[model samples]
Target chain A: MNKVLITGSEAAALGAKLAKIEVLGYYPITPAFPAMERLSKYIEDGELNCKFIRVESDHSALASVLGGSLAGARSYTVTNSQGLLLMTEVVYHAAGLRQPIVMGVANRALSAPHSRFPEHGDAVSQGATGWIQLFSENNQDVLDNTIQAFRVAEELRTPVMVNYEGYLQSHTLEEVFVPDQGKVDAFLPLKRMPALDVTNPRGVNTVAGPDVYTDYKYIQNAAMEQALELIPKVAADYNREFGANSCGLIEGYMMDDAEHAIVAMGSIVGTARLLVDELRKQGKKIGLVKVKTWRPFPAQAVNQILKNVKYVTVLDKNIVFGVGGALATDIKANLYGQGSMVINGAILGLGGGKCGVKEIKEAVDHTESSENKNRSEWIGL
Target chain B: MAVKNLPIVPSGDPGALVEAANYATWRIFRPVITESAKVNPIVTLYCPDGAITVDESGAEVNYKLCKGCGICAKESEGIQMVPEYTGPKGVF
Candidate 1:
């Protein structure tokens, strides 16, 4: 393992290089472009034998990647914010085709009072697209989870998007432990990618009737359901092989004796971890649950972990109108009818706003209060 | 109708035209590729849906795949776009 100080964007390229992606399809989008740029440089440098295509738009980016995957190649792409939204058209098509394409999403807020800030608005909005989503907490998480994503995506024959914050995670530099290429090879071997061949031709993605469409979705959903269990297995396997503890799914930090749980995803988990430690030092019974996988949500594990907790506060970086955030919605649904556990939703860090100690302190301030029951409101507004 | 026993992977029998949509019914003017329009690549090349294929025999239009775009007739004077005798008036 080599410890190199690099940004999350550079780490992403390193991960893709380790996976040895055959084709990279991408467009120029802020925060997300650097990763693809670095990967393209690798291809240009002849260090990696790969084909890099600079596409016109994120839609074409994903479409061309899908083409590469269809032709039996381990394909990948990356985008952020409006770019991800634009690629929305091809997202479902790739999933339906079961192409094992991995995309890196530098999560950014959607426009209309445009800001270059980070938020879950981009990745989380694509929740129902059937692409497995893994939220990277830091630079190392970006590197490791990206490698793990290829295995998960290929094993399940589904696509995965490794999401990190736009500027916060993408641009921030950290000392990342990049695993040896040979070790990564042992963990994830390039078994000739299962793709349609022209010689032994097969009609992939033929027009389907209503029932057939339903069947395709049923199978897709079944794989997603299976992913909840499969992700941990791969994650554990990767960790065992690498001797590194890259948390696969949702991880419980300081939750054993705590009555209050703060759930956070993406880069915000770093902040939440510190907050939990600080709160504990003050003799407060507080803990943190870092959600690593947003899609194929580990509801069963979450219910088990937070079952005894008195109250749960979901600090969402992305907001879902009228219903709070997507993370809050999923968590609340999982916790419903099981107990009288009060679930409070607090939205903060939209457009990449600084997640201040004061904001988080206020969010968790009412945790011990009797009046903190089910309060859903914006925090850093 | 229930679409049953389909392959889960995106694979289907090559060249197997199962329940392929027939464009003949929707065509107002069908391209009649006569023997005179022999090996006209222009007619086949201009077809947006690839309804026609050209060979030594002539340009043959696959009505099932053709959208009756009339591009073949426009591109080649030998191929005529005649109103189909089948639509609404009577069953062919």
Candidate 2:
């Protein structure tokens, strides 16, 4: 109804309620657990009415949601980190069958040390799963993206993952504008989805054989490529409907007249915006390119945005083992041989290690001074 | 939005050709309806792979897709399971 201070988890839950999801499935895990908790609270308090099932594991959570979707109901679930990894197989199944389910992924570090903080590793690892992946910078981004994902997923008959940092965006409170029920209802008009019929039962996941396997995947690829264009159109329509300009595939913050740009994703982009502002006040010609969409990599838009910049510093929250950061690899692959633009990856945070303005400044300093643009520097190690 | 609104056939819808394959090649033994067995055998529902069907006429195992799992013969009285390659001249 108005601007309210709420955590991203609560905001996402409210957004799902606003979108009138028919079923909610979840198996609790850290960071993402709170969002599920908030949604359950909504159900308990009668703020939202839906089928809420607490399954045994993340795998079942996804499967249960798939059942709901198959039954022709608007459905969603929440999980991140190890839970996301566990649901990998079902995630592919959801995409393969063209089930329009939306999921809120509070991104967290993949475990080994069993750390508890933010990292993009969890959601980034699912790049090939064919779900339209959208990253959020704040609570509002999380909420808007949750609702926007429904439209995208349902309209395209593809699943979507709205990702934000685990602790940074999940637990921390921010002032977010909560849309009213009437407007949200108008924004998301209910449409009957293709449903399972018991009277005339149909099989699910039958073999595609060699005759149609590649054809099915080709359809999937075409749908994904279509998303590359549909996403920005949805964002434009959302901005027109909601009067909010933050919904898009990428945010080119102060890129005009800039000589250098800092490319990053998720909550780090919010932090980088401040750093970019401070540096600009000191007469530095640096700008921030916050990547809002990852799965539909948005390479053309990114290429155009960074075309004139002579230096591009990349900040990747997740490392790709032997290779550089995932975002860095993506940006490098897109920009290779295009120009004399020097690109360096500032490996600032992995496993939720401490990364702040100071650490980011060190990376920026290295980018501004270093001659070798080929190596990824592990800063604040 | 063009592909988004299009009705794409989902993966698991049932049909006669649903999951069809040349599964009979994987069969160790074949299912047959015998004269002494029940008139209308209930072996139609036992095949997990949907390889066998039965009516008042008897059971017909679609060998093209039957894996010779012996599920029908084990579950119903009218069906019998026999080794596909019982001699040197057998296909197996």
Candidate 3:
């Protein structure tokens, strides 16, 4: 129950330990490597009773957890960038199979000219994979989101990816109050895997042809859709117990009556918050809308928040290459024909470059001053 | 399986590129390989105690200075170059 100065990776490790995760299947990748190391140390010290599977690749890391989960074990893993991509196939399958697994993704860029800093491309690429993607902006959220992630995943019978910016939050040390183990224990009881009886012998992950494949896919989509409704309710309950509420799908900071706002996800929200403070001091009616959850898209919530705003700029760390920024496209899809000056996309901080408060402030300033017709501008060079 | 005339980006260190590409490809293909076949080359690359590092930008790696000692590849089975092709020009 003591306060500890730890990085986001350590916070995730501690959260998993507190949740009493039974098995951890993982491969070491940048940013996420620290979490694996911490968990390995915990396993060595016997502080937590868990099976640590040292997999050769991220694909095995996720597959092992999926296998473990099917065997009725509370399982988890950590991955990033190409590692996340390596596990992309199972990532989709894990959710389709309704395995209540949780993973920590240190959001990094995908390949071509791969860079290992931090970006949302890795997690965003898996958007259609049907997992609940939660973006954490700080060390505390990293811990809280991870602990709740398991519970949310179980409730919805799907996997959850707790996405945070690599190096930005993952490696940066911050003071995070370790919640009381007893309190966490009360919220997340020892995860008892659904009773798998030999007498019942229900078939799991069976091969389905055209007839049932579509039906199965619908079921998976329906479960993900259910998460859009369930996440907020679970987050509310978690807040009541933990005294901390992560804005659920999207968090709005000083948005009421604001004229222009910046929309983003992951660690950039922190930088946006600081910029908002500075802009507020100058009496510029600008605010920020940080998407805490991205998979379900939170279309209704995003449109509702940006309904009154005249100009909205979406800052995306990862670009879709041919088509603008990923978040920008998503926002545009949600806000189609709203008559608001919607900027479609902006790409910045590719290959792990830092996006600081100055860059955020500049983006807002340029967007506000520009007279273009719904165009996107990349910030921080 | 031998990749025929794989299009590899010409960067400084081909080994690092191959390693990184192998790691990325492994991640992208992990779920399918692990579930269906355990004998996948990707899985073999990600063997226990293996590691991968991707330098997509080629900003940090100096291929001209590299001696191809294979220290990183040998250290961990998971390590590979970013592009999956070796040498400066990346031929065969």
Worst 10 residues of 2 chain A by lDDT: A203-212
User: TM-score per candidate, in order?
Assistant: 0.94, 0.88, 0.78
A205-318: candidate 2 lDDT, tens digit per residue: 666657567777878878888888888888888777777766578889889988989998888888888899899999999999988889888899899999999888899898
Which portions of model 1 show Cα errors greater than 4 Å? A193-195, A200-202, A370-372, B1-5, B10-23, B35-40, B86-92
The TM-score ranking, best first, is 1, 2, 3
* Candidate 1 per-residue lDDT over residues A1-381, each given as its tens digit: 879999999989899999999989988999998998899889888988888877788999999999998877888888999999999989988988888899999999998789788999999889999999999989999999999999999898889999988879899999999899999998887765656766787777777667577877888898899999999999999888888788877899999998999998988888888888888999999899999998988889999999899888888898777778899889988888888787888899899776866788788875555465555767766
Q: Output the number of the TM-score-best candidate.
A: 1
Deviation from native of the Cα of residue A106 in model 3, angstroms: 1.1
Using Cα atoms, each model's DockQ against the true complex is 0.50, 0.33, 0.01
- Please tell me which model should have the higher TM-score, number 1 or number 2: 1
**Candidate 3 residues A1-381, lDDT tens each?**
578899999988998998888889988889799998998899899998899998888889999998788777899898899998889899977877788999999888777775777888898789888899999989989998998898888877888999877888889899887878899889887666652445655445544546556666666777788888988887888888877766688889999988888999888888889989988999999889999888888999999999998878788888776777888888888788875574635567777675788777777777777777355677766
Residue runs of model 3 more than 4 Å from their true location after superposition: A194-203, A371-374, B1-92
Candidates' lDDT values, in order? Answer: 0.85, 0.84, 0.77
